[model samples]
Target: MKRQIIDTIEQYETIIIHRHVRPDPDAYGSQMGLKALLEKNYPKKRIMAAGTHDVLLSYLAEPDCVAEEDYNGALVIVTDTANTDRIDGPYFDRGAFLLKIDHHPNEDPYGDERWVNTDASSCSEMIYTLFEEGQASSGWEMSAEAARFLFAGIVGDTGRFMFQSATEKTFEVASSLIKQNFDRTQLFADMYEVDRKILHLQGYIYQNFTIDENGAAYIKLTQEILKQFNVTVAETSDLVGSLGNVKGICAWIIFVEEDDQIRVRLRSKGPVINTLAMQYKGGGHPLASGASVYSWKEADEVIGKLQELCRNY
Candidate 1:
């Protein structure tokens, strides 16, 4: 499949890469990492990263200003996004061909050609593996800039190699990426450094979070709580994993109330949670996933269902 993707790359003169909405390190890392890799190999081809740039990701990379016309006869490759609905840009299908490269479950496969590997630690790691394939088979070269992007993605998705999803290959890829010229120290600092206000909010979460007897835990971050802490909804992403440190925790949900919908971020130490995410119109990795709920009652349904999962596990 990697070889086939390489051959497809050779056929296109313009390629646009995309990722999921509300970007994460893995999303930006894989999308922009692949962009950097392709641009280095095919200098003549117009390789672009398309999406709304998140200010938080300024440390990593910025997306290109791709106009609607740019998708004409372009090869659109979406990385790290499992479903078409989650893709950031509206022009994904406007391109001539579509390709999907992701590490999530292939539940909503939307691309003409897909290379989904659920075992991959992150889509960024998969991008490095793709680089290896192209290097041996087609003499493809990777740059230090691309290495940093992939490395950041790997670190982010694997929770700095702390999660069980991280395999031996993940460590090897991380090792190879760090060998390139980039400031690993600075990257870690940028990825981990949190504002004092956010920390205060984390403290509040620690104090107020609820855990049932079955070890199914949850925390609600309403707009009122966000206002009290002076933290934006985006900043809350950094705290999703904070509850994992609690002992006897089997699974947890962090519900962030948005304008029109409530964002559900699910994580697990054991028990498959992606299926639960799918029930609420979301899907992702087995251990980590996201979903959306429109009402507080629906949110309670998710929590109750999660309790069932933890109980069964």
Candidate 2:
């Protein structure tokens, strides 16, 4: 599969990379890292990374403004996205060839070629493996910038090597990337640095989150509450993880109000919560998932389901 993907890339003079909408570090990292890797090896090829901007990861790379014509004869490679509906743009099918590279569950496979590895810690790790295999066979090199971006994705998705999905293979892949001579300490500093306002937001979550009898911790953030904190919806992405470590809390959820609907971010310490997320309008990994609900009643029902799961566990 790796060789096939490489061969497909070699056949195309234009390659466009994409990821899910409202991308996280893993999405941005894999997309940017693959683009950098391809550009370094195939300098003559026009490789561009396209997606919506993630405010938190904007410092890494900006999404290229790709024209429709760019996909006329291009190979479209989507990374870190599982479903077609989650794709950031409409140009996926416009490409001459489609390739899907992801570490998520294969819920929706919409590509001519796919390399989906759910066991991998992150899509960035998969990209690293692909590059290493491709490099060995084709004598291509992995650049330091590419290594850094890939490393960021691994760390981000693995929660700084704290998540259970991060295994020995994850460490081995990370070691290879770190040996490329990127500043590891600086990268950690950059990833963790936060301003005072964000710190206050954390305090708010800690203070205001409610705990159910079944040890499910939850917080509902309406637009007014978000306005009070003066934070955008994107900034709340990391807040759900903060509730994970609370004492006696087996499950945690954050319900953030969007324009027309409510977005729910669910996390669990050991229980399988993605099933419950799928019952709602979302699906993801077992321990971590996301869902969308139309009203507070729907959100409450989802929460009730999570609470039941916790009680059974």
**What's the count of clashing pairs in each model shown?**
0, 0
**Residue 110 lDDT in candidate 1:** 92
Model 2 TM-score? 0.70
Off by over 4 Å in 1: 194-197, 204-313
Candidate number with greatest lDDT: 1
Give the residue spans of candidate 2 off by over 4 A. 194-199, 205-233, 237-313
For model 2, name the residue pairs that clash. none
What tens-digit string does per-residue lDDT give for candidate 2 at 93-142?
A: 89999999999999898899899999999999999999988889998898
lDDT of all the models against the reference?
0.94, 0.89
Tell me the TM-score of model 1.
0.69
